[model samples]
Target: MSIFKQIKGFVFDLDGVITDTARLHTKAWHEIADQVGTPWSHELADKLRGIGREESLDIILRAGGKQDAYTDAEKTQLATAKNEHYQRLISTLTPQDILPGIPEFLHDLHEHEYLMSIASASRNAPAVLERLGLTQYFPKIVDPNCLHTGKPNPEIFIKGAAILGLEPRQCIGVEDAAAGVQAIDAAGEISVGIGDKDVLRGATIVFPTTSTLTLANISGRLKEAA
Candidate 1:
């Protein structure tokens, strides 16, 4: 039997999973780093993946040797500035910006009657979903704005399963970040990673990209694992 047969819900991460907006986030963070005279690199952006905006700002601040220099209010202001930059960039987003095979996959899951939710660390998840015309696919959106903690903490995924009226083991969490995979594992759910295998070490299954995944492939793997 397919493991999916035992699954009742599907929880997805935004940014790198459903869309290519991670690039926009990286660009915004880089801009913030430049503005603060902090040394920044793609590696630093990678570290921020699946983290909340404020936590990401804290990471950047620590890297720039300014974590202790800023008060809580100042940190909030910096995070807000970065979010404004991200908002301006994402304002142009549309359905075409969705990652490869995501629309089809979502449609397939929808048709199959799998309950779906978006569990993202991004505070702008709702705006991005609306901009991409993808809000119809998910009935629940667990973003950082509603959660007290971010990915790798499992609160978002746990809330997603709760909203779907399912247990963690009855749901599958799909993600594109290492921290997201960790969160899925920590939540005791099946994890489908959509990025580099090496980085997504804890995922139950790993696909290099969404383009390499399909309903059939997922079902087959679930069957095999079962």
Candidate 2:
């Protein structure tokens, strides 16, 4: 069935969709898990994708069979530490760190004057965009810290559309994580997935990677949906 929308704006996820901070996140989480004696596994890593700070820490604790071992205060401290670590790792980011085809895609969108906003779960969305010199392309970014719920809840995506002065039916939400895609779908926006098809089956359309995410490809998909 067709699920296309008017698509007046684009709602973006920062980490995996704009750049490669996903690895930095994983590394930081891994360090935290090691310190907390969490049994690190691929399954555990997969669960962390698109997860928020507290939820990610909770998952780590659960994997270590230490979910009840830490008090809420202790968990807060751990989450803070992980954020610091991730920040240090992302400090190396520059405009050069932007993922493949991102510049061209953003250029086309900007030239077309399509409104754009960031709907990422990361509190570092602003900093990352500034670092990559992409802040000019996005005038609005939903504050993760202000959100009562993260991805898979659609709150962030909904906020993104609102900031762009558009309804959910007038925007396309692009994401690289299943949880993020689910949020976009739930928000009633067209969802563009940038990863494995099976993992992102919930997306309206799935691309293998950002390298293949050219504006032409996106337009083709949108036309087909129309």
* Regions more than 4 Å wrong, model 2: 1-5
| Candidate 1 wrongly placed segments (more than 4 Å) | none
Score candidate 2 by lDDT.
0.90
lDDT scores in order: 0.88, 0.90
lDDT of 2 by residue, 1-226 (tens): 3344356899999888999899999999999999999878888888988889999998888888999999999999999999999988888899999999999999988898789999988899888888899999987999888899877999999999999899999899999999999999999998999999999998888999898886678878877756
Best by lDDT: 2
TM-score of each: 0.96, 0.96
CA lDDT, candidate 2, residue 6? 58
